[model samples]
Structure formats: C-alpha cells, structure tokens
Target: MAEITTEDGVQIDLVSGERMKKLRSMEKIRLILDGVRDGNIVILEEGLSPDEESKLIEVTMTEISPDEFAGIEIESYPQQEPNPGFFSRLFGHNPPNKLTVIGPANRIETLHKDKNLIRALVT
Candidate 1:
C-alpha cells in the first residue's frame, strides 16, 4: 500500500477498500472525494448505493478541469441487489450493487492493468 503525508504531517495509507463498510454513507463519500482529490485510486468492496454512485460521479465531474487532466475513470464489478421487492421483480429491473473504483484516468488505468494489485488490496 502507498502512503502520503499531508502538510500537517498526517500519514495516510493510499490503498483502501471495502473494509470501510462500517462508515456511514456520507463519511464513505468524503473518503472517496479525498482520495480522488489527492490522486489516489479508491476501491469500494460493498460499493455505493445508486444515489451515492450518481452523486459521486456528479461531484467528481465538477472537480475536473480541462486544463489539468482529461478526466476520471470509474470502474466497477456489478452484483445483483438482494431480495428485490415485488415491484422490482415484476418490472424486471434490478439495479446492481457495484464494486466501484474512481480516480484519474492514467492511475486508474494502471491499477486496472495490474490484477494482482487489485486482488491484494480489495480481497
């Protein structure tokens, strides 16, 4: 795992993932934002709720600059939502529970290219 220190000299581990499930939804969102802002790839094992996913994308998009880098890349492993209600079943629609990654395109690409690293951190 990579590490970085802030100006206040707080050392933070750069590699993180699903173990954060105990955090409240907005707290998790804050961590994601902080990681991305600091140019670190973030992984989420349990993934985000649909609303959180949308909000993440929206917030990240706004944070990007045309002059800085092209964009952020989001990747995910989609899982079926458990115990869909009758309406969801009847409508033949089940939104997925996604294992999401979000970060700068190049770094995110590097992380994706190394399956071993991904396995080590997320597993």
Candidate 2:
C-alpha cells in the first residue's frame, strides 16, 4: 500500500494491487474520471503494470479539469554526468532523466525523451 495525500491535504491509502484490480474491473473508467475530477495525481512506488499505466494515459488525455482543479506540472531534471568507462558504459546505462510531477505528491521523476513528453504526461 502507498500513502497518497490529496490536494486538500487529506491522506488516502492506495493499495496498488487493489487499485490495479479495480482499474481492470468495471470501475476503471469511472475511477479515472474521479481521479481527474479530484485533481489527484497517481503515483506508484514501483510503477504500474503496462495495461494499467496505459489506461491512466488514456484517461488523462480525455479528462478536462476545472480551473481550480487544473492538472499538475511535470518537469524533467537531468542528472549531472561524467561518462563512465567503456565496460561500465557497455554493461549499464545511466538512469533516465528525473521528472518531478508536482501536485499532490509534490514530486515524481520519470525518464522521458524530451520536455514535450513530460508536458503531455503531466497534463
């Protein structure tokens, strides 16, 4: 379970497993709608399943919030870098850029190609 605070400062416990299941069930569409209406951003500790994550993207694309509930902003923060050795570079890759999605959770980092994708994701 993950603890998520709403914009109103109320904390809600979100069981990732349960929420995923709910999102897969008949409640999915409605739940997505509710999430948008409340101006809440969803965060998963380890991330979400592909299907569930896709649903979130779809829902976010459609829901239009009121001025008071405008969606949050997401920004990418690239890590300072010193290129690693050839072996290290070959064996492992650096982490994707960090993204802080400001809203209920204050910050979240996601690897993305560019700021446009970040903007699309946050909206």
Candidate 3:
C-alpha cells in the first residue's frame, strides 16, 4: 500500500500489477503521462517492458509543452532472480515484476537507483 499524499501534500499514485495487467501498453503509458502532467508521482508495481518504455518516451517527446507540461522522469530496475531451477535455466522462465517510478521531470529528481532501491526527491 502507498500513501496518497506526503506531508507537503504532493500527490502519489501507487498502481498495482493487477490493475496494470488489465490495461493495454498504450493505455498504461497514457495513465502515467497524465498523472505526471497533473503533478502527481506515479509508482508502478510492475515496470514496463523495454518496448513499452521506449513508446512512453516517444509519446512524451511529442506532448512536451514548455509552459504547461514538462516531460517525465522515470526510473526502474531489471527483474532479479537469485536462483534458477532446471526448468527455468533450460526454458527461460519469466522473472518477477519490477518496480517503476514516474513523475514530472521538473518536480521529481532521482537521487539514487540500484537493483533493489530507488531514492527520489519530489518537490
């Protein structure tokens, strides 16, 4: 679970993987972009794929407005699998979902990011 607002009243939207799975790639991108435009930080329980992330950047480039909408800042880590069984090693099993954070470029700053942590500054 995630808090809707911080002490300074910054809005945050924590989206679950279940909800994300229900939306198409474009729909998911739109949702993140819209929230960023509204000055809200959006955290995805399951991060987007490489293709989807590229698409999001492409769409954001087209929608950037100098006075109104700044673009977005995004951070994510690759899925980690500590161990792989025989089947996973042979067949290549899917790894667990990763986390992602998206927000207005001007408002959010990624202080640090590693495989297991993402530290962000939101103003």
lDDT of 3 by residue, 1-123 (tens): 364976768899999998989999999998899888999999999888777888999999999989998899999877877877899879866664489999999999999987778999988
Score every model by TM-score.
0.58, 0.37, 0.83
**Residue-by-residue lDDT tens digits, candidate 1, 19-96:** 565677677667777766666666565577777777777777777787765456666666656687899889876464
* CA-lDDT, candidates in order: 0.60, 0.43, 0.87
* Model 2 quality (TM-score): 0.37
Model 1, C-alpha of 23: deviation from truth (Å): 3.7
Candidate 3 clashing pairs, residues 3+ apart or interchain: none
Give the Å shift of residue 24 in candidate 3: 0.7
- Across residues 1-123, which tens digit of lDDT does each residue of candidate 2 receive? 466665756443343544544444336445533553465554332234334445645655555445444433333345435766788679765543333232321222344646345532332
Over 4 Å off in model 2, which ranges?
A: 1-10, 22-26, 40-47, 65-69, 72-123
Give the worst 10-residue stretch by lDDT in candidate 1: 114-123
How far is 119's C-alpha from truth in model 1 (Å)? Answer: 11
Candidate 1, clashing residue pairs? none
What's the C-alpha lDDT at position 5 in model 2? 64
Off by over 4 Å in 3: 1-3, 6-8, 81-97
